[model samples]
Target: MNRLSTNIFRRSDALKSKPDTSAKQPFRVRTGFLILILSASISLANAEPQNQKNEILAELNAAATRVETVKASLQVGIPHPTAALVQWTEALVAYRKNPEFLYLKGYQPLVPLYFLLKSDSDAFSLFVPRVYKVFRGKNKIFDTSIDIDIALIPQDIILALKPLRINDTDHTEWKLAKDQTAFELTVKDKEGKILRKIIIDSSEHVRYQVEYNDAGFPYLEIWKDDWRDTGSIFFPYEIKMKRSLPKKNELVLKFKEIRPNEKLEEKLFQDTFPKDAEVVELKESSG
Candidate 1:
């Protein structure tokens, strides 16, 4: 009888040593389910910010596409470092999208100027009637005396006046203001150099922008205000540009009239240099 009891006790101990797989199976399943939930939560957290950024970009792109042709009459306030008072000049400006062209005619009593840019061909023409001089060049025009640089190029000018189309390859980062009134966006190149920074208001209007040079230096800063709903889009009646680096100057443009999507004649963008004016052709540098 004692021997029989000892064998029975050994059998019971063996049963206890065996694992309770039925309970462990449920625990394993619950752990896996929890991991799945955690993974989904992380995925959603990552997607939300990207979705918001895409929405903001879509709004800006839509507004830009609404503007095909623009014609405006504006008064420009030009400030000189040596002058005590700001010089104001009236100007007529025309811009065409797609092929991208810009024409500007400034009326000043002493020095009338005309500038035309054809981005498709990468050509530019500048005519100064008072001096009887015409400069035709390819790429950029750099003349410190006239205060003309890459900022005057059609691309840069349009970027200042309108919202830029951010590409997929561009590295973009955005943050909401502490007050939650506006969004600040910084765009960088593939190599992580900043290209531009913009501040957009709640109404999706770009209130301010600072454009950087290839070396990642801020060369131009622009502010747009006095926004008005023009049925098709929001337009800014007043724009200011502060230039730095190569020169320090301020240009304020107040639009008297703006016509968007106007049917403009092709000749308006053509360079019309007088036959009597001396033409200077600038060639590209070889290195």
Candidate 2:
């Protein structure tokens, strides 16, 4: 009986020892696994500290290239209107509200224009600067109160704009028939009226498309949207503007001369309003 009791006690001790051994093995394995996981997470967290500066600079370089290509192509097709130019001018007269476009076929469309004078029919234009000079008859003349877009403004303005972003690849368009490089942009107003569409010829940025609303602001504009040079210099040479939405009217322009680096007198930038001309500056919208 004593021997039997001793055997029973030893068996109980063996069973308890088995459980402690198993528990210790599992605990050690768990601790090792946790350490490995923590190390991996810490290494991954500190990988790249750059603020995407390299990526942004690369994009800027590409954009500058696109603009440069346009500037170089400005002088290629000049000395009067090409076949495309004639068609563009014809479209303007047939759809133009000003009627002056009818006899001005020889003159290229610089920028769309309309009178905002309170005394006049309350017209407005795109945010583009106005031109006091025009190609009249056989001579380049100054037409006072004449709604025009000066070349200097368009050339300089295109460069000054901060490149907002590359448009989604989807909405982008090209007129391969006229020139493969021309790119067109179209934006709309809250009323669903076509607000703006402009085309820029990539081959020659000088040629561009500046669509005009009935009010004469570009509803769409395009000029040299691609194949830009490494620099940001640009000019609109061949332009086409289509009035889309409520009405359908289209105007195209061909530049006889597009000088990107033209030397301009500082006085040109100032408001040289005539003494008799009634000039009232419109305050910016509070909204």
Q: Against the true structure, whose TM-score is highest? A: 1
lDDT of 1: 0.70
Model 2 global lDDT (CA atoms, 0 to 1):
0.33
Q: Residue by residue across 1-287, what tens digits does model 2's lDDT show? A: 46645755565556566875865654555566567667765654533423432353345345444432111112112212234433222111111112111111122356333211111022211122244322212111111122432222221122222222323232322223233233344434444455444443333233344434556454444443333233334333444433332323334344443323223333423333344443333332243
Give lDDT tens digits, candidate 1, residues 4-31: 4575556555555557654455455557
- TM-scores, in order shown? 0.70, 0.28
Report clash pairs, candidate 1.
none
Residue ranges of candidate 2 with Cα displaced over 4 Å:
1-236, 245-249, 278-287
